[model samples]
Target: MISDSMAEVLRLLQLDDGFDAAAEVAVRAAETLGVDGLTVSLATGGEQAELVWCTDEAAGQFEDLQFTLGEGPGPDAVRAGAMVLVPDLAQVRAGRWPALTTESGALAVCAVFCFPMAIGAIRVGVLTVVRRTVGPLTDAQIGDAQVLAHALTGRALGATVLDQDKAPLLHAVVHQATGMVSVQLDLPLPQALLRLRAHAYSSGRPLLDISRDVVARRLRLDLNGNGDGNPLPVSDKD
Candidate 1:
């Protein structure tokens, strides 16, 4: 099953155009982990998550809940660059995202785990797997998730590049833009990317959309931070 899952993951990558493969991978991964359901959220988008694929009917509520609210394990995982696992949503009561957690219970999500998707240093999105029971992931499962992350990252990378086009999310564009944004803002690459994210979210737009504008001279980083970790910028093409 693991091998099959891995193969399915590779096939998902081959898609390079649709969500069908991604949905298949989610289902296969769930089977491999013996979990209840799974969903893969691609960060190639903006503040709002774009579902690359989700397995089963149950994944719908979980995925839509996050998209509608703009908050959930997937969002937090991408923001914090860490995985969030709720072995049982009902058991968590304090300091958790009240709305997101509450919705988790409504979705009947027992256990949820997320992994960030990134190429080299550029983050693309997150992949989340959930079960209906409380328990810890075994070492083997962790390894499997890691492999899935790597494969998903590759898929995202391939999809964004338009045959030698230096896209902002493309690894080459990311590195180059990071250097330029860093020098322009006098911030590190990480902070520059954060600034980019900040600018996009503040405008209620997608990060990639903002990135393209920036890369194409249609936007400039203004650097007037709003303390929400969002950077200020002027859009040339509003």
Candidate 2:
């Protein structure tokens, strides 16, 4: 399955257009890890994070809970640039992340593991896997997840392995969304991207989904941040 997944990713990179390649990797990684769901989040400077993709609604909710409340395994793993493994959310000590634990329980997530997507001093994102039952990953499962993360980082960074045109599409949608958001909020582009991330979490949707809408003019964020339908101009220059 691991080799098949790798081959599938390579094939998609070659043939598919406008697909969420990183999300595909996360889905396969989730299956290999025997987790119920998974998500990918990109971070720079170890402070702010943007959700790259999620496998399902459950995965989206897990990411949303963390981002909305501003605390969880994903953040911890990214901040530490190491794995954050919680075999059982129920057994977690209180005050570490009260809201996260409580909300995760509501989502039926019993165990979660977050692996940072990093290459040396450069940090890209995190791969978070969720299970409905509590148990630590086997050594083999951990190893598989690590391998997926390495491949995922290169794709996320738009490294040269992929064809030039296909490579930038993953990051471009996000950059375009950031520009639209900047205009909507009348804020700097950086702050706009931050708000976009916050909005995705609050809406319980994957960042890619929301960004697609923003780019397609199907969804818009007003100054008040409530969803709006009015199309806003998005510049490629942004």
Best by lDDT: 2
Clashing pairs in 1: 43-124, 43-125, 46-207
TM-score of each: 0.61, 0.59
Error of 1 at 197 (Å): 22
- lDDT tens string, model 1, 4-90? 566665565555465663555567677877778777777645677677677856766787787677776777777877677666666
Once fitted onto the true fold, the runs of candidate 1 whose alpha carbons sit more than 4 angstroms away are 1-8, 11-18, 159-178, 181-238
Q: List the residue pairs that clash in candidate 2.
A: none
Ten contiguous residues minimizing lDDT sum, candidate 2: 229-238
Number of colliding residue pairs in model 1? 3
Ten contiguous residues minimizing lDDT sum, candidate 1:
158-167
Residue ranges of candidate 2 with Cα displaced over 4 Å:
1-25, 44-46, 162-238
lDDT of 2: 0.69
Candidate 2 Cα deviation (angstroms), residue 68 = 2.4
User: Residue 62 in candidate 1 has what lDDT?
Assistant: 84
Error of 1 at 1 (Å): 16
lDDT (Cα, tens digit) per residue for candidate 2, span 1-238: 3456545655554443433645665566567678898887777453667877788787778887887787988888877778899999888899999988877776878889998886443467888888888899887778767766766665665443423323333666867887887787786554565556556656766667778888888777655545342233333432
